[model samples]
Target: MTQAQQLREAILAAPLETSNFGETPQPGTLYLPLSHLKALRLDAHVVVGGRGVGKSFWTAALQSEPLRRLLGLAASELKGMEVHAGFSIAEHIDNYPNADVFDAFLAEGGDPYDLWRAVVLRWIARQAGKIIPHDSWPHTVAWLKQNPEDVARLMQQPRNWKGLILFDALDRTSADWRRMDSIVQGLLRTTLWLKAYPGLYAKVFLRDDQAERTVFNFTDASKLTATKAELKWARHDLHGLLWQRLINAPDTHGEILRDICRSTQQENVWHVAPEMKSESDPQRKAFETLAGPWMGRDKRRGVPYTWSVSHLSDGRGQTSPRSFLAAIRQAAEDSLERYPSHEYALHYESIKRGIQKASEIRVQEMAEDYPWVPKTLAVLSGMNVPMDFDIVREKWENAPAGALEGNPTRLPAQHIDRGWDGVREDLQRLGLLETKKDGRIDMPDLYRVGFGLGRKGGVKPKG
Candidate 1:
């Protein structure tokens, strides 16, 4: 076996992990894209992004002291700063209430605003070595509502306690759109309430849809909105993240990848250079060594460097590090099995297969986020896209009504009653589909291949 084969095996074996729901990402897994710098600062109160874009990843990362120190490399304010989660992916009943508690609290005619303030009052009390109500969520909330003076004293009780409180996975707050909106709005209002105290801050990680709603309807909400940051990944950022994981691969694979990347060992882990973090010649040249220049026989076939990221993009033209890395790992496996003697670690054809794998994963994510998505998209699975909306509408109309049935708790199409146009709008908002310039509907390969849709001269869905 040659070094290229070894590289293929190495790439095949790379951990390449993405969001593990709520697990703390390894220190070596830290690759702070320059774009995310503002999102991690102690001051940014509201961070928004679509799925697979590091919303949860950052939530878990900021919880670890070591990871926070690593993040301090980009944002100096994070070093040694205390951190806590008001709400997160992980369940910590002692720290905050879970979805069921929230549902029950609201079901009993509780205002979300009072419930959230109760959550903060408890955190402040615990830090100050003072006891507050904790028998149940409603119990604490009752204490908060009943004793305004004590709550005020606890909130203002001057202490050296200074830190950032994070709230994430807000979708779990409630399944119903209206209630979820109120709950999120309540949290934001609570965050705004926290703004009065110096040195105490709250950061809320919200989904794009959640952030776009009436959650910011409260007075002084602009204070949080003004500091809002978006989590995004550029074409180069995805490649940069891939090499970060590859260079830090264990043992010999790590050494091999580090050599290709010219990575130097730093802080007990391989550090990707500044050049690799951007769309510079060094970054482009590095990927070419693994994937080769052209995606096909020659230049006329298109450049592999640009083609891979472009094809994996969502309807909004965003390429997430999660999807990009998953596709690359699958690509390496395909290249090894099908083209063992190929000049590069990733063959053009194998790259195509990787898209399908990533698409399937993305599709699963969409279904989980919106259970109605799969059935809705399934109505047009066998058809080609970039077609007229009328044609797509006709297909959905003829389908069984049960096809659109959704889980009782999960949200359905925003305009389910408004008909196909509403469903189309929902899909577009979710990055599943887009309207072309000419009003023809199109689906990005990220979703298209997974939904089993065909495209003219485009990557095909798995047979």
Candidate 2:
């Protein structure tokens, strides 16, 4: 077989799926970006990121002793530290409260600060093989509030170990914005209080919107805010991640890829290292070997390496590594099926189809995190972006307001309470929509393609 045939077969077999990272990340497959190092610090209390940006990935990684030790190579602070989950998407009723328990606690006029303290006390009790009120939240809160000195004494008891408590999927604690904010605020207050005792720390993973809300209303919220880090991906970071996955492909593909992109051996694991200062240069060349230099037949259509990422960016100019990888995977699959005899493994048209696939995946994720967004956006399908704001409002007005049909009524849709203007602002904040310089509203291709919106000259779905 020719080299093109081998590359095509290899591309078809490359392991490019990112959905598992959102669920339970495989430690062996993780690509720790340089920017994420700050987030791994023990002192970095708050980790803010958009959906699919490795919040859950880190939450799982930190829980595993072996993984944490491996990660310590990148961030030396993690070595020898004890880690525990304060709360996670995977339910652990004994360790933390769920949505029902939180609602009951609030309904009884319980203080969030005191309630969170009770959670910490439970962990302490478990360590000492002692029992506290586990049957009732109110009883637990009463015990914690009534015996502050006892709690302090228990926490102060010297231990030979240092521990880090991680909290992710806090969104599962409550659906209501106000209630979730209160619970998070209380948790943050408790995290701050934990600092009084050495060797104990709290690391929270929060959505970008959740971090910007009223969770910091109380005094000294800045203590945690000051050390906050966002899980952002740069252009190079995204390309870097692509190569990291590429080199790990099955033997037929991996051997050829290992030659083109150089790697370093550390702890017997092969890590793809940057070959040039630009970083983009090596990444571009690696991709060119598969898709060629231009997106189409010539340069006017743009370079595949740059065009793929730029087009996938959200309204805020952030591109998710999830979407980037998904598009490339889809592009390769499409090329193998539709353009089998082409010179390149990935065709320009196939790349456009890949964006469509990524947009669809993004929409599904948005529905899971912000259910009401689809309720509002589905009405605007086929509408061109950068249109007058008033025109956009009229579309929403005509659209059905079934925002609460399947969601909890108490938990408002991310910003549905603020009306159309509020929803628009929230969308822009989440990078789903943008306000162009001329005051018209525009949708990024990432969201636009999936939501069925169109631009004068843009990729359209296969129907």
Which candidate leads the pack in TM-score?
1
Which regions in candidate 2 have their CA more than 4 angstroms from the true location?
20-24, 135-138, 276-278, 400-406, 409-411
Instruction: Pick the lDDT winner.
Output: 1
Per-residue CA lDDT of model 2 for 331-432, tens digit only, reads: 888888898888887888889999999999999998887777887788888888779999989887876666324356334556666887888888899999
Query: What RMSD does each model have against the real structure?
Result: 1.2, 2.2
Ten contiguous residues minimizing lDDT sum, candidate 2: 403-412
Cα lDDT tens digits, model 1, 15-58, are 79787577888877888888889998777899999888898888
Position 256, candidate 1: lDDT: 84
Clashing pairs in 1: none
Error of 2 at 431 (Å): 1.0
Error of 2 at 206 (Å): 0.8
Q: How close is every model to the real structure, measured as TM-score? A: 0.98, 0.94
